[model samples]
Target: MKIYVMVDIEGISGVYCSEQVTPASGRFAEGRKYMTEDINACVAGLRDAGVDEIIVHDCHGGSYSLNWADVSPEADGYICGTIGDSRYVDIDDCDGLILLGYHAMAGTAGAVLEHTYSSKRIQNMYINDVLVGETAVDAAIAGEHGVPVIMVSGDDKLCAEAKRFLPDVVTAQVKKGLSTQGAVLLPPEKAHRLIHDKAMEAVKKLPLIKPYVIPAPITHKIELMERCQLPNAAGKPYMNVIDGRAYSVAADSVEEARMRSGG
Candidate 1:
């Protein structure tokens, strides 16, 4: 079976502070180790399940969190740099996707480093009138192509969020957030073990997991954090920039919404 794994940094095991997630931050090196190890563990687990192809994607900021040295030789390929480029992924042929090191939506309490895409710009996002974070949005993107999000790993709140939308998704909570910037962390080894095991479970229960689909002609409403970013929110074909800080995006698929909303 083919599996796609996308990993972010804020929700990785042993991450609790913003400094760890940013490339410019002093602790960023530590964050990279955790992020890379977690993915390797997931990859190893998928291999044990008889997975033939694993495509890795660096879903975090600018895709700088991972490097060639971090990737496993078992991986079929890896996608780095800016996301939303379909050219890098064979989404059409993929069987399932795995999300690792994800956090909750902006303003989620007790969520480790919660934010939807951009913490500097987006304040809230409504999908078909339902509040959601990047996880849901990304899932909807894969779901549009008939690929179900089978496994996820993150903090306690993010795990809850994933379960809320993807009831059958296997999740491993690597940490628990005390505040947006604080969390009760888990040892890297322990977190990796959980991620590996859950990934195996997802593959085993593949038939039980369903795509977390959203209705077509979807409408997205975005609330911005900074008024200065209004110009950046310029409208798209089906998306309209409203009230400077709010944008109304109408798209047939999640990738379209992501493109229009610049998420």
Candidate 2:
């Protein structure tokens, strides 16, 4: 089976500061190591499950945070930022998707590093009135392609969010968010083990989990930091201004939503 893995940083174990998630921050290097370890564990587990091809997408800021030298070369993957296009889950040909090091939606209580797209610009995002983050958006894309999200690894809030939308999908929580900037983390080794084991479980039960589907005419509400940014943000067609800081868009499906968001 083919699997697509998307990796982010905020939800990795021991990441509780902005510095860890930013490229300019000194602590980002350490966060990269932690993120890499978690991904490696998941890859190992997927391999154990007899997955034939693994396509990893570095989904964090500008992507390219993980050390490519350390990753298994056998796995074909793409570093984030390399592609100028905004395609979140480019899993058109993959069978399953795996979300690694994801985080909670913006404004969520007790969620570590919680923020949708940008902490500076995005105030909140909703799909059909359901509060969602990157995970939810990407899962929708997977659903559009008839692919199931088999596993997700992140903090407790992120895991809980995933379970709320996808009850049967496997989740590995490496930390518990106390705030957007604070978290109680598990040791890297322990977190890695949990991710690996859970990934294995997810793959084994992949056939049992249903793809998350959204009804036709998908509606999205984006709450931006500045009202003036609305026109630019709504450059795509069919985007209507609901109010200051809020804009609405309609698409035929979730994948179309991603396209509208330039994801």
TM-scores of all candidate predictions against the true structure: 0.94, 0.93
**lDDT measured at residue 180 in model 1 versus the true structure, 0 to 100:** 88
Question: In model 1, what lDDT does residue 46 have?
Answer: 98
Candidate 1 lDDT by residue in tens digits, 69-155: 967888888888865555237787989999989999899988988998899988999998899898898898899888999998999
The window of 10 residues in a row where model 1 has the poorest summed lDDT is: 230-239
Candidate 1 lDDT (Cα, whole model)?
0.86
lDDT of 2 at 100: 89
Spell out the clash pairs found in candidate 1.
none
List candidate 1 segments past 4 Å from native.
83-88, 232-237
Please list the residue runs of candidate 2 whose C-alpha ends up more than 4 Å from where it truly belongs after superposition. 84-90, 232-237
Quick one: best TM-score, which candidate?
Answer: 1
Worst 10 residues of 2 by lDDT: 80-89
